[model samples]
Target: MTISSQSARDLTANITALSDKSVALMHQRSMSDEAVTTFQNILQKVQEIHDPKAALRSLSAEELDVVRQAHSLAESINISVLSDEGAANLLNAPGHTKDLNNDGLTTIGEGNMLTFPPDNAPASFKAAWEEASDGLSTMDIPTHMIFAVGLANIGREPGDLNWVNPYASPDYDYGAAVSEIIESVEYQYNHNMMSFEQYQKNMSFYNTLTEALA
Candidate 1:
């Protein structure tokens, strides 16, 4: 899903307002230190979520789900704390990365199959793969996914010419790729091309991919 610039600004403003209201309520209710800390942490996350310039960081699915639920509970406690629309918008906001719901995996798999077509694969597979890859090309690619694809390329064959290692030590290429990926993700985040949640998801997906591939 895509969020227009204006919509993003509106969402950010709404979240900030809601957080402020929640903070006020916590103070009014004389919440315990632990409870206050929880609210404060949630507020910090919400702020980071709406800030386009924030650094890219991984956010687990559970964390986001919890935040969404907490926002809902806060609204229920004080209707003025958060509007229905604001809560919905925050929950439905587009992710910061392009690897939403395994799209990255699909793209990588399709690309690999197309690049090294299996002898037993049918022609129809190639046609379908091409169609899927073409569609993905039109969307913004997450930096982490790009790095993953590059790593996959390097791992495909010992001496594959497609692998370009810019680092002085070839052994450090993977580390360099990781650094580049982080920088690219941050650039996209700062540019508002992707949401903070999406960025987090991309990082989480990348970590999983790395583990499995390793």
Candidate 2:
């Protein structure tokens, strides 16, 4: 029988956790020879799931049943666990790096997958905005600001700095205003003690609104 997508995903997660633990033990120089051997065995099982062999090895009905049951049990377990170093490592990944450009401008986002302006924009303000707006539609706020703003700023108008200006004219740079909000959101994200996923979700909304209006 084939493994369900959910089952494979669950197993992959457990195996990842196991891999993490094994790596830790290696670093600490604390694993016994037997423990190391057991870890390798588990890794092989994980690889079998990840890289299935083309040849279907024969198994007794009972053996197949046991494998099915194990898969089910793995799925039923809660998987929202964070390892001791999960938070620290997540915040420090290459995606979360905060190095700004020479212009003191840089995009910041969680987990790094998206980059803004998509490496291509027309050489005009309207073309840039249109392209940026299209890209922003697919991006979460954390990613757009963190990955795209530097590119967006290539030759665009400077966003407004005085957000509290009650008399700010209709010509007020709303892009800058949205940027300030994003910056504030980032401030709270890095300073507060909250789940990274939650922070990312909240910032997604904030960014969506900003990008939509921009």
| Highest lDDT against the true fold, candidate | 1
**Model 2 TM-score on a 0 to 1 scale:** 0.21
* Residue pairs of candidate 1 with colliding backbone atoms: 95-198, 96-195, 96-198, 96-199, 97-198, 97-199
Report lDDT (Cα) of residue 210, candidate 2. 53
How large is the C-alpha RMSD of every model relative to the true structure?
20.7, 18.8
lDDT of 1: 0.39
Q: How would you encode candidate 1's per-residue C-alpha lDDT over 1-214 as one tens digit per residue? A: 2235455444444433334455455455655456555544544465546433221123344444433343333322222333223332333222211121111121111112111122222354334334434434434334433344346555554224454422223133343454566677778888998899988765654444344334
Clash pairs (backbone) in predicted model 2: 107-146, 108-146, 116-148
* Off by more than 4 A, model 2: 1-168, 193-198
Q: What is the Å distance of residue 26 in model 2 from its true position?
A: 69
Quote the positional error of residue 185 for candidate 2 in Å. 0.8
Candidate 1 root-mean-square deviation in Å: 20.7
lDDT of 1 at 107: 13
